[model samples]
Target chain A: MTRNAPPPADSGAVRSAGSSGSGSSGAGRPGFLWAVPAAVFFGLFAIVPLIMVAVLSFASWDGLSDPEFTGLDNWRTLLDDPVMIKSLWLSVLLTVLGVAVQTPLSILLGVWAAGHQRNRAVLSAIYFVPLLLSIAAVSVLWRAVLDPNLGVPAHATWLFGDGNLFGTQATAIGVLVFVSTWQFTPLHTLIYQGAARAVPPVLYQAAQIDGAGRVRQFFHITLPQLRNSIITSVILMVVGGLTTFDTVLILTQGGPGSDTTISAYYMYQKAFKSFDYGAASAIALLLVLVSTVISLIVVRLSGYDKMRSTMEGL
Target chain B: MRKSRPNHLAGFGSLVWLLVVGLPLYVMLVATFQSRPDYAANGPLAFPEHFTLDNYVNDLNSGFAQYFLNTVIVTVCVVGIVVLLVPPLAYTIVRSRGRATTTVFRLFLLGLAIPSQAVIVPMFFVISEAGLYDNLIGVILPTAAFAMPVCALILTGVMRDITPDLYEAMTVDGASPRRVFFQLVLPLSRSGVSTIVVFSALQAWNGFLFPLVLTQSVETKVITLGLYDFQTERGVDTPGLLAAVVLSMLPILIVYLFARRALVQGLMGVGGK
Candidate 1:
């Protein structure tokens, strides 16, 4: 069960410390031999193209000429493109809904489940089944369910008014968000549950002795203790939200209009559908930059690097 | 000893939440057995009057077997390459000392920051130029490449848990580097390796976007694309489409059922919480 838990003592430090263990000349000389095959594969596939995407973001070639460079033209298109703007706004809305709305609900359910003696583990597994299933599958299942005429709840016509929820622009993105939230809430819960279980029992005991109720102890002790977990989950959810493609891709394909197009799908559409690789690369670049920066900011603001070095000092 | 708080309201709330999450899946399962006539007449929620295997039989006959085979091959190859490739890389990152080696590790760490979804733009060009377009090899190469950063990261973290004394003892005894790796590091890193295999397999199996962009033809289709195209082709055959969906999903679901603890724990580690 402890198969992959990171060492408690500043995992970042562990990397540096472990690296330095081979400081002597003989030890240092032998192991670079090992990193080569992987480095080659990674370089060819991951590292090179990552750099290429940045460079090619400006190269205007519609699968025709050999990618002639046109500086900032693709980016300029983004400024004028309504779909681009709509996609950007939708991405932000999705991320915000995930971070602000869904995460708190995950923590709530996670904490509630944690208090149980049995069934917690079983229930948690069932809760996360949606997460482990293919998003394509989830989208189809939900589409069928929300299909108004064919969906199960369509029989209970009174429960859902005008049941074709995916047909409208307003409800489409909202339903997409709901489906993603449904799938992921359990993951967040599991993360929170792990963090909650890690909270020492003595704190709750001490709070009880002082006559504090569950709510008081939760706010005064549990919430503060969970600060790092909360931040971790939020950044993760945001990153997930920003790059989310499958849910929207399968669920909407940026329709009943380009209404549900998040940036990821928008980039896909630009490249494959519209055959505009340059603009697609620009969108892809912006998306990675935005999401990566947000995660980095979370790391920076959380003082995790500082905490790592501080833990190393001891 | 700690006082336990009985929050009865939360208990009720969690059950409600459970039903809300469970209902759609239950509906999907019920629909998998119902005929179109039954489905249309009774609607999606009601129990199937006739539990039929006709949908699955027809679905399998309609080329799901090929899709399943492609998915199996892709997932297996990706996991195989990753499992073989990452341990050595993580070990080298852990045990090697030098500016070059450190840079190698840092580049890998940077891979975590690079989203594959974004990288797919240039990857499209790269894959096409390599003549791997509409090739499962095209899918596998990028999939393995994207999986490395996290795979290497996880293995590095796990590798660091090995004591320096273990390596020192092997080295001082004049054991070859390869000898030390095989005899000492590999066995210790088994759990870490298994965790990443499952993680990467799940990622590859569920991957929709890469397959969407990179592979063009039916011969190269992965499960994600297969399910998408199958559902659309089947038109109003919800049960058949869902039968295919369930068929596509069963492999990973079975894997998850057995490996849930490792999957969850390893994921927690991956998240670095």
Candidate 2:
């Protein structure tokens, strides 16, 4: 590999020049060539495909023929399609519900786990187990456990009713949200746990000295201190929720109808099941736009982009 | 630490959450060890009448062994590609003052926001046109590419923590960039290397969307996809289905048991993903 290439011929001369002026432009620095391989590789698989997605959004293809440019036909049809509109709403609903549910729950768990007690350590370790399972595995496990006949629903009919949870719209959506929260809250909790542990103790001491109790200290000190982590965790949840597919595929199959078919799963159906590559490309582009806009807005509002430089300073 | 009180409220809450997290896990485990008839008769939450390993045995006797092999190959290849490519890239992003290098860093930052689902449509076309569709190579390439931005971000963060004085000392010793990289940068960033290896390995091992879209044959089926097929194909066989689910996560569970700290750190780094 080029990583082991010999130093430039002037290296001895540059060394003799000494380290007094070893600034950003020093001769010891690697060239742009070092970044080429990753850049090209990422470009081929991520960037190029992204561009092709944009172009394909304007063309029609069915995986069996060449794509032909169709202008805004796909977009027009999507604009009028009720399922597309509903899918967008469902995506937003799931994302918002995910953030709403996971944020506070993980925050509480994270702060509680930040304690150094022996029992807390053991409990936190158990909480971390769900993070080990893949999303597909988690979904499959939940599906079987929630089966109306042989699973928990049969025994616990008081809480679950007839247990046709997947047969209705509300329960199906509830299951999607709950399953996601179950699988992902641990990751977010870990994030908040790290952040909570990093909160300086002197601040809490000052709060206590000022007659603030535990709850007050949490709101005044802990919540304010965890601002950046809150942003990061929420962004991850939103993106994960928007693009959630495997769980939906395994759990509900977007079912009872198109009730649980969020935009990401809908896009898969459009392209693969219906073979409407053009329409799916449009939905894909919409998803990219929605996530980017939301991410940028969050970054702008919270100054997260500026936080990157502060992290660089570390 | 503020040991102001026993915090009985928080303890109770934790126990409640423990049940929420633990109950399904208990069900999955117990069901996997029970015969199907026992499971059907007693329900998911009931104690098993007799323990059995038939579920796991049946799953392995089926196609799971092949899926495990395929997932292993994908994971190793993805991790290998990431290890080979990302260090050099992160090293450059840290050390190189070139304008292009900054652009490359920004590119990855932008890449961070582009989810893989957004490009699956064109990715299928591109992979097929390249004659790689329905091949493990098809899944490997895209998965590795998507994993790079996060790995680059993490490794660069780690490398950036190596102070300027260290780099200057190496420069003062007349070391070339390559020498400095191998001796100082690589050794100093050992934790970061392991973090990326664990991170990318998990991503490759558990990846679903790419394999779901790009590949079709049973030959290239990864564990996640195989589990999905099991659910759709033999969903009613709860024990067998849950056993496959357990099988899909076994390797990661072993890693977690042995290297809990490292795995936790690696997963925390996935916050950037």
Task: Estimate the TM-score of every prediction.
Answer: 0.92, 0.94
User: For model 1, how does the per-residue alpha-carbon lDDT over B1-273 read when each residue is reduced to its tens digit?
Assistant: 253756687878878888989898888889889888998888887888899998889878878888889988999999988887788788777665545667787677667777888888788888999999999999999998888888887787777777767777787776656666777888898888888888889888987877988987888888788888876676478888888888888897898879986687667765643
Task: Give the alpha carbon lDDT tens digit for every residue of A95-158 in model 1.
Answer: 8876777877988877766665677667777888888888888888787777767885477668
The residue-by-residue lDDT of candidate 2 on A103-180, one tens digit each, is 999999999998899999999999988877888889989989999888898899899999889989999999999999
lDDT over C-alpha atoms for residue A149 of model 2: 86
Model 1 chain B weakest 10-residue run by lDDT: B1-10
TM-scores (chain A) of the candidates: 0.86, 0.88
Leading candidate by lDDT: 2
Position B85, candidate 2: lDDT: 88
Q: Give the winner by TM-score.
A: 2
lDDT of 1 at B138: 94
* Residue pairs of candidate 2 with colliding backbone atoms: none
Fnat values, candidates in order: 0.62, 0.75
Error of 1 at B248 (Å): 1.2
